[model samples]
Target: MLGYGGTSSPDDPTLEAFKYQKMLADRNVILSSCGIEIESGEKAHLVGHDFSAIFSSTIVFYYPQVALTCTLMSAPHSPPGRKMDLDVMEEITERELGFEFTAYRPFLLRDDSWQLIDAHKESLLQSCRGLTRNGSRTSCLRDA
Candidate 1:
């Protein structure tokens, strides 16, 4: 999880949190456009077929960091492991959007000093699925 601390803004302590939320939403669009069956309001299950052509293709195009981060997670340090977990969460995005996999980096802003924040990886994954499902439900209702 990426956490942004040291923000001087009294009005936007949650700005980073909201930014990542939008990132997850954007990732969902990429997945749906790739032909994944992400229905609204349902938990996404990674099926074996999902691991085959569509998902594999999506991962190949959009989630290269999965392998890299997984490898790094297996390394002998806490920092690398945390980084790896972040990558893994990003991979879930690839699964959701059947896109070609790619590496992901958090957007960093420059302040007076270089401040690092944490990304909530689990929340990202959960929110993506939730948003996708919610969209699906809205569409279905509209159709009905």
Candidate 2:
């Protein structure tokens, strides 16, 4: 949450809060600050997509009390298998798909990517609302 937009600046203290194991407590602090009160037996429900899913599961693993329910979108929960960084995954992806993912391009590195994100926002909302391409509701949502 520290690195996420509008949160604390990316300084040493914030960086420390973002550490994997420490994030559970930090999340509680943030929630408390926001006037959220999770009852003793209540678990936080987490929703995540793509890379965020990793953080969601890891948080659940480190502190089951913090959260146990997760709804992951598009990308499934990919539990860590081995030590493979983005570079390694990029190579493997190129080999399999004959193309590079957008993260590699300095093209989408900063605010330059905002337009793309905005363009997809509506479709993303539709998928979340379980709407089909015809603007009809469906049991399962899929982008057209």
Instruction: State which candidate has the highest TM-score.
Output: 2
Question: How well is each residue in 1-144 modelled by candidate 2, as lDDT tens digits?
Answer: 545556665558445666666765776776677666554555667876765677777766656776657777655555555564666766776677554442323534566555765788776566556576543232122222
Tens-digit lDDT track of model 1 for 1-144: 123344333356667534534544554565468664334522232221311333333432344442222212212323211334656744674578543132313332334223222345554445445566464332222112
Pick the lDDT winner.
2
Local distance difference test, per candidate? Answer: 0.37, 0.59
Deviation from native of the Cα of residue 83 in model 1, angstroms: 13
Candidate 1 has an lDDT of 0.37
Candidate 2 clashes between residue pairs 3 or more apart in a chain or in different chains: none
Per-candidate TM vs. native?
A: 0.20, 0.56
